[model samples]
Target: MQRIIVIAASAGSLDPLKQIVSALPVPCSASVFIVLHVGPNQAVLPALLGVLTDLAVVHAEDDTPIEQGHVYVAPPGWHMRLETGRIRLDQGPKVNHVRPAADPLFISAAETYRERVVGIVLSGYGDDGTDGLLAIHESGGLALVQDLDEAKVPGMPYAALYGDHPDAFLTAEKIGERVAALCG
Candidate 1:
């Protein structure tokens, strides 16, 4: 069980990510933060996803307080970080050639929340979240990866499995169920 959940995905990941979010059970006490690959002008994601999930979905803003049962999507061009119950967005240099890399977000959340964090890596083209998931593991947090066969782009999950070796491999819906179970 964890108080914070961070999800990272890219390249053919939108559908799975959306499913994961929409399937998340209620009484969800943990706050969800997402890092998805998008262009600088890609601002419609939060709204688009909001329609699919019961939880409030909004684009993340700098220095915004983190809340339970809400999903925060990292805005384009900024790296999002978790800071003691709040969020901080910065224009940091890109990692893995992506501006809003998952490593920074996962690492920051793990560093701040320690064992009270869960980091999940989903479908994506390249290896972006491996280091971050490793950081989460080192911090005693839960690390999960989507099943390689199920992912639209298996590269990211495979990398996480081989490079970081997460605690579980699951489908998006199963992952959501697991998250809900953690609250029990």
Candidate 2:
């Protein structure tokens, strides 16, 4: 099965993302892509996520082939896209007030993978992932939003749920379980 999972988060996300990634099943067979808001000059995110998860994590490279068992991170200041089973990096203008916006990645994945895609909108400020998650849902992909009660910053997920009801509204632990189920 071809699987593409996108994880979106923003403020107060590091710890929650770490927990969710760490709890994910080992030797995952899905191509996991992460879009996290970060300062342009911040340290590498893939390295940080790698230390927290057992999965092989690396920053996405333009034209790099997508492979299972690897976790790819959108490099700071760039939007990550999926095209013909490979990664495409874009230094385009910011969308939703974020450079490495979640919408672009989710939209790109929906276009490329359709029903094979799974979009997760986690804790965050603003509404970066709201439109993207809707796009995913419209494209026949599975959409998940973090439960507001469990979110550190509930704006993103709340916006997503209100904008379009996701297929799953889950807590962090349940989200991990659902992701692992998707990989399975």
- TM-score, cand. 2 vs. native: 0.95
Clashes of each: 0, 0
Reference-based TM-score of each model: 0.95, 0.95
Question: By TM-score, who's the top model here?
Answer: 2
Residue pairs in collision within model 1:
none
Off by over 4 Å in 1: none
Weakest 10 consecutive residues of candidate 1 by summed lDDT: 175-184
- Give the true-structure RMSD of model 2: 1.1
lDDT scores of the candidates, listed in order:
0.88, 0.87
lDDT of 2: 0.87
Question: In model 2, which regions exceed 4 Å deviation?
Answer: none
